[model samples]
Target: MDIYSKAIKVFGKETQLIKAVEELSELQKEICKFLISRTGNVEEEIADVKIMIRQLEKVFDKEIIQKWEEEKIKRLSKVCEVVECAKKN
Candidate 1:
């Protein structure tokens, strides 16, 4: 079975949410380490987070997820644009 199926069999959806939160926390720690020490395993942490997200996708509605993703991209792009404009000022 695939990883998502395996995860479901072992942990179920409820526990998987907790797992996702833990994974995200780990990713945050890795980012903080990178910011402070510049030697963090960011790639590995991102992979872990991605795997958790994939597991989540199995339970969530993909259409809504896609819409949210697009919205986030737009919001982030606007943030970047504002930052760029500030840098030019």
Candidate 2:
């Protein structure tokens, strides 16, 4: 009855994966447009990407994905600190 269930019924794993990629691409495009023209539906594109990501969670292991995401964030945070330090120097 939920959106994910409906989406799964209509579009299977492979189709959903493709749609996810498309949605992410759209989000990226919107972000790039914002950087240049400073006019684009960035929020709407982000929402679409989030919806597609949740739809993806139905097929992928959410816990594992989240765990890896946290690890990546921690690693990126360290990299950000290094970059900041270099900038200050």
lDDT of each: 0.91, 0.92
Stretches of candidate 2 off by over 4 Å are none
Candidate 2, backbone clash total: 0
Best by TM-score: 2
lDDT per residue, candidate 1, 1-89, as tens digits?
89787997798899998999998999999899999999888999899899989988888987899999999999999999999999999
- All candidates' TM-scores? 0.80, 0.84
- For residue 63, model 1's alpha carbon misses the true position, in angstroms, by 0.9
Cα distance off (Å), candidate 1, residue 69: 1.0
Worst 10 residues of 1 by lDDT: 3-12
- The prediction achieving the highest lDDT against the true structure is 2
**lDDT (Cα, tens digit) per residue for candidate 2, span 1-89:** 89896898787888999999999999999999999999999999999999998888888999999999999999999999999999999
- How far residue 22's Cα lies from its native spot in candidate 2, in Å, is 1.4
